[model samples]
Target: MNTPSQLLPPPPRPLLLLILDGFGERKERENNAVHLAHTPNLDSLFARYPSTLLGASGPDVGLPTGQIGNSEVGHLTIGAGRVMHTDICRIDQAITNGSFANSPVLQNLLHQAHNVHRELHIFGLVSDGKVHSALEHLFFLIERAASQAVAVVVHAFLDGRDVPPKSALKYIQALENKLEGKGRIGSISGRYYAMDRDHRWQRIHQAYQAIVHGQGMRFPTAIQGIKASYDTGKTDEFVEPFVVGTYQGVQAEGIGFHFNFRPDRARQLTEALAIQPFNRFPRTPLEHPPFPHYACMTTYDASFGLPIVFPKENPTDIFPEVIARHGLQQLRCAETEKYAHVTYFFNGGREKHFEREERILIPSPTGISTYDQQPAMSAPLIADAVIHAIESDRYDFILANFANPDMVGHTGILQAAIAAVESVDQAIGSIVNAAQAKNGAVIITSDHGNCELMLDAETGQPHTAHTLNPVPFLYIPIPTSHPLPPFRTGGKLCDIAPTLLTILGIEQPPIMTGLSLFVSS
Candidate 1:
């Protein structure tokens, strides 16, 4: 039942794409934060508005079978309105087929290193988290570099968010085992320093000092440093940066290479390493004598790459860029961590700045690593921004992401997650009110599941990882207008873009590849 474009009249209102991060719908109420919380606004929306379940994990989000949904793939699918074969699939395939060693990207970087007579610096998260680069893939790259007679310096960032908290030692030891006598393994730090989305140059500076100057709290060994931090109640992701070997003032001087396919994270570290004559760090007057030549596994941001200069023209165009080309004005609003998810990932891994599109980034609360302390987070601020935009009627569409449930849920704190969901519910109510007042429609969905499935089924302990749960897709109709149409079926998140575009009287681009949820007359 595809709705024909001719039968559709001019939309009576604008549309809002409200993404409640990790707010999935689950029936298991025991320890389920969303179920326990007083989400009156969300409940009201569900009862009144037309809604359906969205398949958010594994194949639904376009990952390999059994792969849990993460922010990178979730947002990419949402904005693309299509199933893009994500980096997770490609990397997994590469590892399985033994093609990673012979990859063109790896070969090109190796060739560049050989031609330039410089050591190849390989940097990335050494974890089994499928969302980011995998430890197996990193090992293969290192082993291949050695075979190719290339001098390689491996900079491994710690991971605790995706994996079990404070499990950095396991990954570090594994890498050490692989790199024993093969290559130099040095400059170990937390993912927080390397994967900063906001302008947290201070964190990046700490990482740089550890990598280039070998300056940090002196640790006799890698294991000791990790254990010391763990003993002090610091998770691996926030542990102070430390060098692997003895701090002998050895800098990794060579062409740098890092494998981060996801566009949303880790740009700050790459920029700090790549940029030459760097003096941005406040505490230390630092300058890289040689501008680090580097290449990512895939160009994360096609619109803008390293050296930190805004490009006059984007190197490539993504979904938002294409939408802008069609004369659609879009407003993207999110907090620091997910700012890239909206701007960079939503735009198809390109950092394009369109005159018509505006981005609003509310800083995630600083000085606190865990989100449970500030359970409400910046939901109200983001909601206010969206409300103001809807009131102004300046943009054709507004996309907002409330990161409370996801952030707080990851902490495995039941009470905080409950409060986080409630906070999001309150914000949703405000956005809906503002939209309805201005004759606008609201479409709310989530990236993936988290707080809804809080406890592990067997263990009954708090589950910290994203779950393979379906999220709610609630559509509140334009104020005072007869319903446009009911969705044909419960669809994937990728279907969201076409649905929104159709509602806004915009043509669905062929590249979108998603079937419209509505049926034709």
Candidate 2:
């Protein structure tokens, strides 16, 4: 067998890997924000550099076939350098194989609630987004609870970002029909208040008050609560917390199950409900009754000390860990909104930073309800930080995420998305300029697609959800020293880590199954 170092040719030193979040490639011009944006820098790079489109959605990123990719799975696949099974895939497999119904974890929780004559509370986003939580998964849990004769109450978190803006009522009606008096909708709130991961304690406080104490705007039914929010010109995502009909709050000894498998947005609320002496934010006290016993569908945070029904088996020997083992100095930078993607998910779901790895988190735009108002959304600040790092020459490898395209794309505003794309293009131009000054190479790519397809082709309605389109991957060797190897086509997001390793003169670990795009067949 050949030694590890002999597997690939040597590469340029001090590389910069830039991830343009939610940027994708599409041929269609109409309603494509990326196509409409004045992105001369990106246009020039695509024309001049060695570039190829990489598959980012569905089975390409290890999600179920036909499922849209999310930042979590995208970054994880890039780091793992292989098609790793996602939480949704694993859960779906379990459900299909009947293991989910027979899970001891689920059975125990149901039995506990039934024996104690207490309510079983299920909380999660109500959508078919397949990014955070799926409505079908919620339905499965409810059906199981009803089978056990357990009293089930759903604290529905409305979703508009991943679906149509005014579609909450339709989902609510479907849920109501599914319940059919077997269970009840206890509370309704927008994900903006309930699923905040940005340390927006005030938002979390409102959700907590509404879900735990039944202390928000009251409505007799879930449908009325959503319709009232629509009357106020608010979409599903911004619906204020409200209680449904005389539903009492989660009581002591109650069993709580969080159905959101993805961990990022679920972390804060899980912490608030599970941790004792909860000090993350000021919380209203429950004087006599203690907090309910809680379990998550997957591990949100291992430190939270809660049981997980389907715990994630994190991948080993991922890209970052290999770099750390080689004693290479690395830097990870992103705005607050996507900091976890670059660090935690890119590190294979581990929050701990490796040796010789440095992280910088620029504060994302604050005090803004939506990113459309500030479409730039701190990309300039992130670019400045990245350019400064390139100049310092302190890191052998640097990675930064520009969150503009993805965050603003979710707002479903075409003009704002164009601005967001333009902003990232400008930032990429600056970073490339700085890298060239240092004789360094830069690889530009994206986690997934969101801003590319802005409007549905048939309906002409806003297409706020992630698309199945492929993302662009461009490799630029600063100053054009010598002829570089041609990149192979038909690549996937999993091919990125091995490609980066090949370009950095690092050996691809045997655990990684993805081939480097730089290698010819």
Candidate 3:
């Protein structure tokens, strides 16, 4: 096989990769945010540049055959240049094979709770969405605790973004049925409060108060809390924190376990619960004793000093590592909402930066209850950062994530999603103009699909969940003296890193099985 340098000419300087989050394509134009929005720049780019549809979901992005893609796996696959089995997939397999029940970390926590006669607190987002946390995993953990005769108390974090809006009741019922009156629900709150990644201490404190102090609105049952929220015109995501009947808070000596495998959202809460000298917010002191034993399904951060049932195997030879090895400078920029995706997940789950790598995080809009209210969230700001980096010529490669479509799309508001697509399109136009002035090429792609398919086919309700749709990959070589090769069609997200490396005249690493998308003669 011809090497990358042999196939391509010398690398172009100041390459910009603009990831339009949740941007996807489908034939149905009705209720499709991208189709409904006026995206002149994106339309012209597709017409003028080398564009093709790339598989972003399901097996193409290392998810199960029918499972939709998520930002974590999407960015991880893009950087790894190969299929990466996600934590959820591995945990599911372990459960099916009966290995999860025998995991040492889980066994130890259960034994501690059982032997000490302390309540075992199982806390995490309760959903079947398979994005952040899965309901089946919660059930498995609860069942395992029950077998050991350890009392289980569930702190349910409601999920409305990953699943349908107001679908928390179904999950609550499922959890109740699974318990069979064995374990009781302790407290309930929306993931917005419990799974915040943006260091929103106020929101985190609300969750902490509900879980640790049982200090929230009182409800006779989980169903009543959710029903009251619905009566007040609130969806699952905005459900106010509430405590269930006669529930005491998590005891200091209690064993706590968080089942959410994804680290980005789970990290803050875990730190608050498990870490000492907690100074992020004024943590209410526990009366009994803080978690005598605290563990998680997967490793969130090694610094958290918590035992993990399934520790992450960080990928080697990823995009950033290769770039640093070549002595090239690169910048990863995104708004706070997706800062991790552009850096952490994009670097194959490694939190540390490469030698020549720089990062910029634009704060996402604050004080908004939902992103739909501010549809054009931080895209213009992120685009400005990328443009400045490109114009400065300080970095060989620049990558920024436009978080409008995915973030606003989750709100299931059609008008807001349409506005978000337009905002990203405007931002891209500005960035592309700046790149062209500097003779820099711009590559546009998306991690997954969310805004494209707005309405559910059967229910016709707003489809808030991500779709199994293919995303667009457009490569625009701007005013270059050298002729660029045509991009190959039928590629996947994993092929992106190899394609970038091939364009930069860098050899593809042996560990990267994904083929480059550039057509070779």
What is the alpha-carbon lDDT of model 1 when measured against the actual structure? 0.75
lDDT of 1 by residue, 1-521 (tens): 54544444466456788898998888978889999999788887888867888888888877867767888778888888888777667676777777776666667777877776666777888777667776766777787777777777787788776666666787888887887767776677887787766677888888878876778776777888789888997777778788876644333445777775554465667666665545566423344532256667655554334521111122233456566887878899999868878887787665666759999999898878678999999988998888988888888778899999998998888999999999998999898988988878888999998888766667454577788888888878776645456666668988887877777667777777876666676
* Candidate 1 colliding pairs: 1-519, 1-520, 2-519, 2-520, 3-519, 3-520
Writing each residue's lDDT as its tens digit, candidate 2 over 294-323 gives 889999998887878898888998998998
Across 1-521, the per-residue lDDT of candidate 3 in tens digits comes to 65544655556688888898998888789999999999999999989878888998878887778888999898999889998988888998999999999999999998998888887899999988888888889999888998999879999999888888878988999899987756899999998899888888788889888888889899999999999999998888888889999997876666799999898889898888878867887765633226757998888987877898999989899888998999999999999999999998998878898899999999999988789999999988998888888879898999899988999999899999999999999999999999889878889999999999887777666888888999999988757556566777889999999999988878889999988888776
Write out the backbone clash pairs for model 3. Answer: 252-289, 252-290
After superposition, candidate 2 runs with Cα above 4 Å error: 1-10, 286-290, 519-521
List of clashing residue pairs for candidate 2: none
Q: Report how far off residue 89 is in candidate 3 (Å).
A: 1.2
Instruction: List the global CA lDDT of all models.
Output: 0.75, 0.87, 0.88
What's model 3's lDDT at 292? 50
**Cα distance off (Å), candidate 2, residue 450:** 0.6
Worst 10 residues of 3 by lDDT: 283-292
Worst 10 residues of 1 by lDDT: 307-316
Q: What is model 3's C-alpha RMSD? A: 1.8
User: What value of lDDT does candidate 3 attain over all alpha carbons?
Assistant: 0.88
